[model samples]
Target: MAVVGPTGSGKSDLAVALALQLDGEVVNADAMQFYRGMDIGTAKITPAERRGVPHHLLDTLDVTEEASVSDFQREARAAIADIHGRGKRAILVGGSGLYVRAALDVLEFPGTDPDIRRRLEAQLADAGLAPLRTRLEAADPVSAARLGDARRVVRALEVFELTGRPFSSFMPAREYFQPAVQIGLEVDRQLLKDRLARRVHGMVANGLQDEVQRLDAAGLREGKTAARALGYSQFLKVLDGEWDADQATEDTIVATRKFARRQLTWFRADPRITWLDWQDPDLVAKSVGLCR
Candidate 1:
């Protein structure tokens, strides 16, 4: 099964509840939640919040490494197989549209080339995003088309430069695995925006700055994939003396709202998803029935 929605939309809670009812383990599909020490910023589910349901792939990586969609697909597939081997269902949960799509359907992408990746990283470090985006626009419009915006464009180009194939080429439609159900969660827009604002405030109170500070101190510098996450990067600027904490928090709220909007736009385009009003109490029963 698949659980997808905008961030702060109660998808995690629903996934956890569904997993408990189905006696299933959860495989995270969110790209950010893979990193260690990014808990508050990514809204990673805590052990207690997991409600004793097993969760795989959250906090499983060093902050310095890039966790790509391919990596997520490979790990999630193994995790699902493991759960099935144990005679339990597998619950996929997160808002990463690409990662979710990769895990549950056909995805063909190029293999890794370490040397090429290093060269592209060097270029990205020296030349900045504009030049990289221009190059990718000229070379691989297909991959570029999949990008959500400039941030994704940069990531896709980095992959393209390293693999010598358009990143999208590797993602040709081929069945990766079959999900019994695909559930999409949505709340009223105003309610979602309000929840996101409150969530940002909660993150700040939850020591989001301290969390990013720890990552920075641990040698994960700004502009790396881990640091580039929403609230973490905004607060990194606060730590760098570019913004006050109050301003950082405000900026983070705005950024999160915009991100939620984009997530809605992305998920809405996928006709396979069955949308759910997350505020409904019968979501678990409904989702379980859908899976059956």
Candidate 2:
């Protein structure tokens, strides 16, 4: 089973509750939660919050390392296998749409060529996203339309070069690798925005700035992916004197709201997910029934 929704929608809490009641373990799919010492910024559930439930993949990476979706696919599947081997159901939970699909869907990742990747990366550095974006548009307009980041654009271009196919051709269909259920938590849009703003303020009060400082000292800026995470990136600016704490907090709130909307768009595109009200009184029972 997988629990998915936008951040600040209580997906983690719901996952933990369902796991506790369903005799299951949790497999994290959130990309940023993989980094250690990113607790405050990532809203990582504490041990107490986990309520003695075993959680796999949280805090598994250092801040300096980039997270690879392919690597996550392998590891998360292995973890699921291990959970089933122990006669326990695996509860996959997170808001990262692609990571969730990569873990549960019949998705195949194309092989990479170091030389091709290097050439693309060089072109990106020299000319910015315009050249690569233009190339991707000509080669794979579908992928080009969806991907805006330089790293993803380079990867898409590399895939096209290596496979002679559009990167979007490899997009996951509505098929699961294993029999599973997906539960989506839904929230009121305006209320969620307000909650997200409050959540960002809470993070700041909970010492997100200090967490970023520590991670920065540990080389967070060296990790392209980790450095650019929503709250961490904004707080890094605060530390760099680019923005004040209040500015960073507000920027984080806005970015998080945007991210939440994107997450909702991505998850809602999947027809397999069963949407449920986040405040449902029978949420646990309903989720368990869906799993059954």
Candidate 3:
């Protein structure tokens, strides 16, 4: 079973509830949670909060290591197989759309050539993302349309140049890699917006600033992925004296809301997920029913 929703939607709590009830363990699919010393900012569940449920793939990376969807897919599937082999259920949990799909769906990762990648990146640096994006549009219009970031646009172009195939061609269909149930938590737009704002403020109150400071010393700034996490990024500005805490708080709230909307858009497009209200009184019971 997989439990997915936007951040601040209580998917973590629901996963623990279901794990306790169903004799299951959780395999984390949250990209940010993979980094060590990122607890406060990433909202990582404490050991006590887990209620003794074994979690896989959390805190496996240092601040300097990049999180890779391909690597996570292998690790998650291995964890699931190990859990099943022990007569325990494996519950996949997180809001990362790609990581969730990588764990549950039949997705393939293509190889990359460093030479090609560097060449494309240099072209992006010299020419900016527009020309590369235009080239990608002509080569793989689907990828070009969906990918807005320079990194992904470059990757799609590299894939096209290397394999003579559209990057979208590697995307898995809705078909599952194995039989599994996906439960999504749905929240009202306004309520979620408010909840996200409160969550960010709570993180600050819980020492997000200090957490960012600690990780910065541990090389968070050097990490491409970890450094760019919503709250972490903004808080880094606070560390740099570019923005004050209040400004970081407001910026994080806005960025988190935008991220939530993107998560909703991604999960809603998948017909496989069963949506449940985030505030549903019987959320765990209903989620367990789907698993059974």
Q: By TM-score, highest first, what's the ranking? A: 3, 2, 1
List model 3 lDDT by residue over 68-132, tens digit each: 99999999999999999999999999999999999999899998889999999999999999999
Residue ranges of candidate 3 with Cα displaced over 4 Å: none
Q: What TM-scores do the predictions have?
A: 0.87, 0.96, 0.97
Question: What's the number of clashes in each of the models?
Answer: 4, 0, 0
**Residue range with the least summed lDDT across 10 consecutive positions in model 1:** 171-180
Q: Which prediction has more favorable lDDT, 1 or 2?
A: 2
Candidate 2: tens digits of C-alpha lDDT, residues 74-155? 9999999999999998999999999999999999999999999999888878878898899899999999899987888999
Report how far off residue 93 is in candidate 3 (Å).
Answer: 0.6
Question: What is candidate 1's CA lDDT for residue 179?
Answer: 47
**Best by TM-score, which number?**
3
For model 2, give the 10-residue run with minimal summed lDDT: 120-129
Query: What is the lDDT for 235 in model 2?
Result: 89
